[model samples]
Target: MSLALNIHSQRFQLIATAVAASLVTAGALAAYNSVSKRERRRNLSEEVLRSVSNEASVHTLPDYSVYKEDASNVRYDEELIREQLARNYAFFGEEGMAKIRGGSVVVVGCGGVGSWAAVMLVRSGISKIRLVDFDQVTLSSLNRHASATLNDVGTPKVKCLERNLKQIAKWIDVDCRAEIWRKEEGGDLLEGVDWVIDAIDNISTKVDLLKYCHDHNLKVFSSMGASAKSDPTRIQISDISHTIYDPLARSVRRRLRLLGVTSGIPVVYSTEVPGDVKLLPLPEEEFQKGPVKELGFFDDFRVRILPVIGPLPSIFGLNIATYILCELAGKPILNPLPIKNRKKLYERLLRDLLHRESKLTGETINKLPIDEDDVGMIFEDVYLGRSVIPPHLVPSRPALTRWILTQPLTPENCVVMEYADAEKHVKECSNPTIHPRDIWGEDVNALVERRSEEVARQRAPA
Candidate 1:
C-alpha cells in the first residue's frame, strides 16, 4: 500500500510540473507576440496619420500659430466656420480640400451658376477667387441670382457679389471685374487660374472662352442652358468631346468645330430642352414690345416665354456650384460617370439584359410615323403633355394599335424611353414659376422713399 501510494504521489508531482512548464511557455510566447504587434500597429498608424494629416492641413488650419495670431485671416465666428468646414469635409475628403486651397479658380458670370460658384468656392476655403461680369442687378434677378435685391438695381454684379462674399469670409481675396470677359483678354485673365468656370449665356462669348482655354491648356467647365429645366439627375460633368446626339451639346460642338476645335474639352450640360419654355420670346414682335410693366423690364427680358414650367436658374446655379466643388477637390461623384468604362463585360451584360427584358415586356418601343396632316397641332400639344389625339380615339384592338405604330403619320410622336433620357427631360423642366421680381417691383416706391429718408437722416446726423 505504501509503495503504491509513493508511485501515485510521484506521478501527481510530475503532472503538476508539466502544467507549470506549459503555462510558462505559453505566457512567454504571448508576451513576445503582444510586443511585436503593438510596435507594428504604432508604426503603421503613425505613417498613415502623417500622410493624411500633412496633405489635409495644407488646406485646413495649416498651423495653430497662424490661426491664433491673425483674427482677420479666419472668420471671427469660429463656430460657423467650423460648421461649414465640417460640411465641406463631408462632401470632399480632407485630401481634396487641400487641393482646392492650393488651386485658383475664376468664375466668368455672376448670374445663376456663377453666383453660387463664388459662394461655394469661398465656403470651401479656396483663398482666391476672381469674378468677372459686366451686368447690373435687375428686378428679375432677385430669385436665383445671389447679390440681387431691390436696392441692388442697376448696381454692378461684381460689387454686389463682393458685398455678399465679404459676409462669408473676411480673409478671402476676391478679384471682381466689372467688365465683360473678352476673348482678347482671356490669356491674361486666365494666366494663373487653375480652372475656369463658364456660366456666360452669350454663345459667341462661350465659344471664344472655350477656345482660349483650350489653347492655353487651362481647365474650364461651361454650363448649358439651365433656365428652362429642372431635373437635376440629367445634369452631369463630362468631356464635351464625347457628348453625342444631344441637341444643345450638339449646337455647342458645332460651334466649337467651326472654330477648328477638336474634342476633349470639359463641360457641364443637360441633354434636353426644358418643357417650360413659355418664358422664352414668343415671336420677334412680342419680344420687341419690351419688358412687361407688370413683370418688370428685367423679368420680361430674362424669362423665355413658353407653355410648361421649367428649371429655374437657381437650381442650375446650385448644380454648377456642386460641380466646381467636385472638380476642385479631385472627386468624381458626378453622374453618368462619363462613359469611361465601356469595356467592362459586366456593364455590357447588364445593358443586354435590359434590352432583352424590354423585348419580353413589350417595352421595345417603336417610333410612330408622323402624319403630315397633324404635325403642327401634335407638335404643339406634345409640349403641353396632353395628347392632341385623345387616348380614347384609338380602337381597343391590338391590330389597330399595331397599325397605328406602323402607319406613316406626319404628326408622329416618336418617343424614345430610357431612365437617363427621362431624367434629363425632367431636369430641363425644373422651373419654379414663383417670381421674386414682382416683389421688387412692388417695393420700388418704398425704395425711393427710403432713399429720401436716408438723405434726411444723413443730413441731420452730420
Candidate 2:
C-alpha cells in the first residue's frame, strides 16, 4: 500500500511540473508580444510623423503631391501590381516580382538618363525612388531629357521627374531633392537604398559618388558620356577598369585610381568608337560662371555641356533600369561584359590615357621599363588602394614619386629618399624634415595648367 502511494505521488509531481513549465512559457510569450507590439507602434508612429512633417516642409514646392506617402496604413495593391507585372510574372513569378515592388532605388541626377530610369523603375514595379538634381529645365535639355517639357521649363529636374513619374504610376512614391547630390548628403540619400544610379554627367561628382558608394558598400551603376553618339545599339555595360573609347570614362578612371578606387565600377557605355565630332561651343557664361566651378565643387573634374540625342539617353536609362531590376531579382545582368580580358583591354586604355597626358606634358611616363600590360596591372592595383610596390619609382624621380618612391624618412620629411642601396643615405642626410620638392623637382604642372587654360578658352561665338 505504501509502494502504491509512492507511485501516485510521483505521477502527481510530474503533472504539477508540466503545469508550472507551461505557465512560465505562457507568461514569457505574453511579455514578448506586448513589447513587440509597442515597438512596432512606436516605429510606425515615427514614420508617419516624419512623412507628415516632410510634406509640410515642402508644401511650397510645385507638384509636392507626388512625394506624399502616408505610412500609417500600407495598402498593397497586390492584385494590380501582380496583374500589371504579369508578363514579369512569367519571369520572376510571384516572389521575385514582390521583391522588385519592395526594393528602393536612388537616382542621382534627374536628367536624360535618370528621368527615364526613374519612370522605368516605377513602371517595372519598384514602388519607391529618390531623385536628386539641382538644375532647372532649360531649352537645351528638351532634346534628350525624358521628363523635360515646355511646361517644365525653369523647374527643378527632380521635381519634373517626380511629377512625370506620378503620371505613369499614381501609387508609387517619388522623393525629390531639388539639389545637386554632393558627398556630404550621401548618407541620407543612400540610406535604405538597394541601388544607386549614377546618372550625373559631371565627372568629378560622379567619381566622388562612386568612391562614396564604394566605401559605404552601396551598389552603384554609372552612365558614361552619351554625347555625340547616335546609335542606341552601341549601349553596353563595361566595368570602369575595362572602359575604353569614352574620354570621360578614362579621365574619371584615372582620377578614381588616384583616389584609391581600383575596382570595376560598372558603367553603361558604348563601344562604338567616337569619330572626330566637333563639340558644340558653349556660351561664355557657361565657362566663366559655371555653377559647379563657381561653387568650388570637385577639385579633379568639371561640368561640361554635351550634345545628346533623344534615343541614346532613353536607351541608356532603360538599360540602367533593367540592370537594377535584374540585380534586385538575383538574376545575372544582361549584356554585362566580364573582366576576363582586362589585361588586354587595360593596356589599350593605358596607352590611350598616356598619349592623352603626353599631349599636355610633352612626355610619357618613362620611369618603368616594365611591359605595358604589367604597368596596367600595377596601376590597377594601385588605384584599388592595394599596397603593391610601384616598380616604376627610382631614386632619380622628383616629388619622391609622390610617396611611391620612399618610406618618407624621418617624421619631419626632410629626407623622403629610401636607402638607395646597402643603406648609406640615412646616415648622410642631416635635416630629415626638409621639403621633399627641394630634393626632387618636377615641371608637370605647366602642362596641367595648359590643359585648364585650353578648357577655359571656350571659343563659342556668343
How does each model score on TM-score? 0.52, 0.58
Candidate 1 overall lDDT versus native = 0.57
Q: After superposition, how far is residue 417 of candidate 2 from its true place, in Å?
A: 38
**Which predicted model would earn the best lDDT?**
2
Give the per-residue lDDT of model 2 (tens digit) for 265-316: 7888875544435544555656555443311112222344544677898888
| Candidate 2: clashing residue pairs, number | 3
| Cα shift from native, residue 58, model 1 (Å) | 36
Once model 2 is optimally superposed onto the true structure by TM-score, how far is the C-alpha of residue 200 displaced, in angstroms? 0.6
C-alpha root-mean-square deviation, each candidate? 18.9, 22.4
Best model number under TM-score:
2
At residue 331, what lDDT does model 2 achieve?
A: 77
Cα misplacement distance, residue 426 of candidate 2 (Å): 40
Error of 1 at 230 (Å): 3.6
User: Taking the tens digit of each residue's C-alpha lDDT, what string does model 1 give over 1-462?
Assistant: 455445358787898889999999999999999999999999999988887889765556534444444445554555545555787767677798778767788889888668877887787777788889898887667666765678888999888998788766666778888888898766766768888988887656778898888877888877766655566666666677655323345446656876888676766765443442334444657556454321111233423332212234555566666666777788855553654432232233234334433443466734333221122112122222121122312222101111012222122212222333323322332234522223223353243244334223312210
For each candidate, the alpha-carbon lDDT, in order, equals: 0.57, 0.63
